[model samples]
Target: MMNESHAGTARAALPLSWAKRGLVSLFDSALVGGRPQQRYFAALGMAEDEIFTGYDAVDNGYFAQQAETVRVDAAACRRTHQLPPRYFLSLGRFVPKKNLPALIHAYRLFLNANPQSETHLVMVGAGPEDFQLRAQCVKLGLQVHEKSHIPERAPASGKWEQQRGSKPGVHFYGFRQIKENPLFYALAEAFILPSLYEEWGLVVNEAMASGLPVIVSERAGCAEDLLEKGFPENATFTSISVRRAGLRSKIRRNGFVFDPHSPEELSRVLGLLSSVAELRIAMGRASRVIVEKFSCENFGRNAWLAAQAAIEKQRSPAPAPARGELMIPPA
Candidate 1:
């Protein structure tokens, strides 16, 4: 059994073709990460029974519980870290594939459209593109505040909110540990993952579990299964509801899905979420409900089922030799 997820426009060439051939010849079954990944496997002539989705997941319970704890003292955490009262959160490596430049440009457009909006863009991560991204922020005239290192398990300083100087700008909170992320998620109003090509964005899961509306790139592997939500809060969460919501997902989006290449589209989404508090709240609630179905336990169950299926297939006897065909005996 194989467990890999790489299905995006960027992977469209000789490499992917070779990968498909290898997969078909080498693996009897595969555990995929998302619905889009199933399509990739299906294209390789794999049967539905041979392809298992939902192989990627995070500790939703841990993120949720830690976020709840942060919420209990959100004001203090925000002040100590000097985070904006309301902001858009983006958690990922600052790489070209992650499309950090496009996000920053869209954020500029969003700020231009709503000059009075208080929402800021907070990016958390470090990579080779770190300096380039910071330069872009500076060229755009966006105040770039850098919080390079966060002490692990350090007590929060009792700082006053007014003294922290919260403002609407781009904040770069450098690489954070798993335990330190919930505070950033808890204080955020929404999450954005604008990757040019993502195999499976697990940060989307973390954000959803933390109860924030998400804006995901259409190219992300998880978008097909985790991005769309259009039904009202009162609607039941079922496959039937999903089908019904699919009809209105384009017009009545809760969790937004946008083309990563189009900064205008992402800008518009940012503006909408910033202006409408009610819409943000509704979408955040829906995100939590949707992400609950894709828990770590669900991933474990699917993996076990796939392994069992592979074992069963192996245990089945080989077909009888054709008539007059001689079988060679090995010494």
Candidate 2:
């Protein structure tokens, strides 16, 4: 969207050459919205060096430290949030783009598929679409379901007992303090971001940092970066090719990417996460491990390199080679 402004009337007076190069930060995928954005920049007369990939990143230290801080009182959070031992979590603004409706629908689907699975859905965040989401929840029978009171006390095992008669449903906690988010991630069995079209999602990074497995849409920028080639358990022994080979395997993936915004796909993925504890642990580890490669430090370094390349390109005062000519293989 920032690129669109460069072509705006506000910048009409600036010479094209004087524009030099601009940096656009992109998240982890080369597909989805990536290709179109690149074409836009190229059409705007940006050369390869002029536009550099600055990936989306977050403070790993902050999440890591917060995770420890929150873990101290995790059970309290679970009770306060009315969360089960295992639940799928989605956090984002209540906007259409975030696709909260689809998530709710998928949650319904999950419950229908696994009527006995006590797993729940927790959505945190408030937005313009708030009323509609609540309405949808009500219509789906999630909001007004029958409930048998769960006892306030914990069992001998130390885990909270499930509500005997209440149906599993979405727990809508409107916007929460950012500081409390780590606790939410820590409590969740897995994190889900089913955005219809999100260029980059920082919450995915945060969830990964908190060591929760994630399920994001194919269009999410972080999906591939966090999912495709996450940190190898043994880099010394396992080749990247081997890792890629097992991307869809439950043992290897941090999450699964779904297509074209379907509730069924999201539902199926959620059901998978709900069914297996081992899968959740492995994927959560993978997400956290992969995120290290996309740290804020890495973003800064990549941006600096791009700027230097652009500055040098601008200063060279030489004619750029023709596009068609440059693509030809040399004899």
Candidate 3:
């Protein structure tokens, strides 16, 4: 049998306890989402070959194709959708665990520091936190526009100078279908997922496949495998590291990773990406390169390998009974 781990905190400990007692081998094989989970199982006594990585996946090719189609008429698509010309995208539920409030606060910080900047923060998805998140935007003096209310001729850049009683900073585009997501992914400068905790953010894969650089929170499960030059577990982005290397130097080759709890780090990262157009282009390309490895083909191949390995193990003869040990024959 091959099993995937998706248990929550309390339930997850049961397997660890079993593994500690040398019982984990009861399963023929196991698969994990990424290296982070792989390290966790390895630490719990799972063997290297018994564990497969990259089990969580999405149809990268589909999203890539959709994004390409949208790119052909990107300008018109933006107008039809009432989307800002250049903005960072956040696509996920508006739940507390997403830490959207922190993202909004960081965007505020970035705006305060870069007053002349015109890049908006476009949020797509609705959940319990919708009302609260919108309220937070209002409190921070950042205008919130629902998808329907956005002007047809939304400004290509800068504040909503043309639209009266409207500000252009944070947009709540509401929920989008899977097919419609590529439009936003295709047009955005970059994608961001600032979840406080996520088992595996498939949206990260979608964004990467759509050729958008990502700014993911370190706590996201995909952060380790999907982010280029995966964030160092021990690498602290404290004020000390920021000063020593400078902000530009800290930008990872693929994208940025920040502490979800630290709005300051997220703010600085936003500023860095916004100022470096060349870097964004390069990083977006890098995202495509990295995500290609997690394609549906690779996922199927890994599953086949696990099944083959498990079958071979099952066909092998059982270990001979030890001295003074009783063995029961198969019924």
Candidate 4:
């Protein structure tokens, strides 16, 4: 049921057959991939009865651990340097689908609109698309800085500065360690994941737990459920409305939805966020409250329970071989 990245291609190719077989259930962690797979499975005669219930992974214990870490890191960051009141951070692959280009464009707009704002954008993660994304950001007038002596090379001081003659507000910290990532999140004012597609987007949950407001795409499955719970009021949208106008109108009031292709809209939202410090703080606090129900321990427990239920269902004996005349043939 877990549609891991490695198996996605094969599963995509046999959508119909997989649905008919009914053994496979697609659990989309990346929000972008889940919706399409759900539709495909439905088309192949797999009813809601055959699929798993609920989408968000709940884990209370992990949340507690993460919360403690976030508090410590946030305090340490405040003591070390005078950090901005608010900033944006993202953690994902530097790929096209992750939508770095649009993010860069939107950030550029945000900076231009508020030249005096102290907001910063921090991006982490490496992929084949890193160079292209970096190049695009530079072209859009956002400054890029490579973190010299990465963990693979040597011990890093975790210190970074603005590049010379670059725009006043943009920064890029390339290839940071996983352990150091939480520190980045702790120092940020908000988390922005403007991905074109995602299956479940656990990073959003992590951001929420870190007490950071999240601005994610509607294409993410987590958004659908998270929005319902009313967490992270600042989680903006960047996708077309799949629902008709009626439903879209109802959801639009809950979050800011923009066309993923339009950097202007994205910039406008960021600019608005940057201008209002209280807004970010309120949204961040709200996000933390909303994600309390989605902890890692809860997720693990629920997954185990679901598996047990499925097993028990299978163990029950089938009804007597339906009026068959030759039930014991060749026995």
Candidate 5:
């Protein structure tokens, strides 16, 4: 039912019990949208009789239209320098919940294992927790690049160079305008979202729409449905073991599972992605196919239908109580 837990403290301040009851009374089918969230709603007194889940869909048409608006004008994008062969792009705030540390560790491993690989990682987004992450990346012997709003000059502190070695390729593009993001996405070879947990990774879909291969963590809710439904038949599913559970479980395990705690595992996956061009193209095509199904038009239609059904059921009269004698006397 569009659980709002992601709002965290902000949601907790509201009158959740009243809100739940009000919502239940208003709709026929209460569709719980995220993993772990259905249970949260249940705890708020929502019953299985009223709750519905299992099918998670988004308005893909809206996103597709949004994707179309990306600027093809290279001049607007400001390509100050040539991009590396395999650009590892990550777009998320430098927050712990976004799991930047794990990604950093995995990236270190990936670089160490393939020193000759002409790959560069571009992280977009900044937050309070960025300093420590920057320090860690430097300590690990990986190059770091910091992009700023004032493009005329670089940071005077020399911190970026100290942490990233001389002529670092890694960049922190401060805050590009929203319209300019597609330009950055256009430059990348592949998209990586190694979050420890995510309700639905919109960026994964966005990257796929941009025609880039994606490497997302299993914990992401979108991985269960979006990736599964969209993944190419030939694209290899990492982390899932068919030897343990055969094809069905393997399919279920595919895109939705990964060891976020292990950098080595992440490195291995990225390594495989970088090493094989055919695999990347196949996976990219599969991602596009899957994303098309989730278009905004489809999501709006389904959401409307689901809402209508719920309203219709809610409007129907409740069955009369049985004519049994009252168990307790009226006060």
Candidate 6:
């Protein structure tokens, strides 16, 4: 939600007295998505000690394990196709907001800078932007991954179709084994998502959970929230408390966050990630750590706690009569 829209201003006009009430909250961010229907309960009006945020997150454990499985499968896929050892992975519909067309331009720039490098750009998923994506690939003298896919119909082989075309740098492998897609995370040196405008790009969460270093658009919600927790210690988390205080930190060094409007900036990030293997490993580890905090289980447990807190508030006894005031009880 790019703040300051007409509706947002109207909603922000909500009464200030709502702040002065008994409450519990589940706001995602402090000020994002308008003034928030909760106002102070959304973390602004409540005492710092009482605010809660039931923000959304992906299943870290599930995605992580799937990534490990794909890690093994990655080798076979790479060998069978003779794909490049160093490559970047992207997953999303070919929508304009996803900026795949711009990503292709950035990929071209990356190739121009690293002509001798064997790095490839393999983007998955399909949408209305498919034809232009392919045209851009061919226009830049980039090779395409020829695997026909119908959005619904199964391929005759009952597997993600895979074939080779005679181009080198960019590979647009449309739809593949829908179930085994997480393997794409295992096969990449890094993951990139440079959206034009995204309230939240969940693929960022999946990619990070899969142990791939990420480069997200600054405008994407996960760009900040994924990095919000910074680095977690090497211990198992038993629960997620309702407070936003514990996990939130200022030290976010997980991955690159660049301007989506600047193709040169995206190209620079791609080039940097492509050239530095050690950097990718370190950042990818940090990504794994950060994502662990935002796991599906953690999100659920924390939300349960928040619900309990609100119920407790609902059930609490009001203060007894003070001075001349009369006491009243619920009938």
C-alpha RMSD for every candidate: 7.0, 9.7, 6.7, 7.9, 6.6, 10.4
Runs of candidate 4 with Cα error greater than 4 angstroms are 3-50, 53-85, 148-162, 165-167, 229-258, 315-331
lDDT per residue (tens digit) for residues 1-331 in model 3: 3333333211445444554325454556666788877766666566678778768888988999999999999889987887887899999998988999999999999999888888999998989987788788778888766562343344344332223332448877777777778988999998999888888799999999998889998888888788866332332334343354355434565788888998988988888778767667877888888898898888888888877777877898457446633322233
Model 6, span 285-316: residue lDDT tens: 88898777767676566566656655665577
- Give the whole-model CA lDDT for all candidates, comma-separated: 0.77, 0.64, 0.76, 0.57, 0.60, 0.62
Best by TM-score: 1
| Candidate 2 lDDT, 1-331, residue by residue in tens | 2221222112343343233222222211111112334444555445544554435678987897788677788788666655667678888899987888888888888788778888877777888986787778778877422111222333232122223444566666667778768877888888888887666678988998888887877766555556664433432333333334333432235767775367886777777667666667777777777778767887777667665665575566556445653232333
- Candidate 1 per-residue lDDT over residues 1-331, each given as its tens digit: 5555656743566555655555464565778887788887887666778788778788888888888999999888887887888899999888789999999999999888888888889999999988888788778877776666444443333221112344578887878887788888998999999999888899999999998888899888888888764543653444343334342343233578888998988887787667667767777888787887789888888888888877776788346547633322332
lDDT of 4 by residue, 70-146 (tens): 66666556434333345688788877778888888788887887888767777778788766776776677666555
Q: What is the TM-score of each candidate against the true structure?
A: 0.84, 0.72, 0.82, 0.69, 0.72, 0.69
Better of 2 and 4 by TM-score: 2
The TM-score that candidate 6 achieves is 0.69
Regions of candidate 2 where Cα sits further than 4 Å from its true position: 1-45, 49-51, 144-166, 229-252, 318-331
Candidate 1 Cα RMSD (Å): 7.0
Query: What's model 3's TM-score?
Result: 0.82
For lDDT, the strongest prediction is: 1
| C-alpha lDDT of residue 285 in model 1 | 81
Candidate 3, residue 232: the lDDT equals 27
The ten-residue window of minimal lDDT in model 5 covers 247-256
For model 3, what is the C-alpha lDDT against the true structure? 0.76
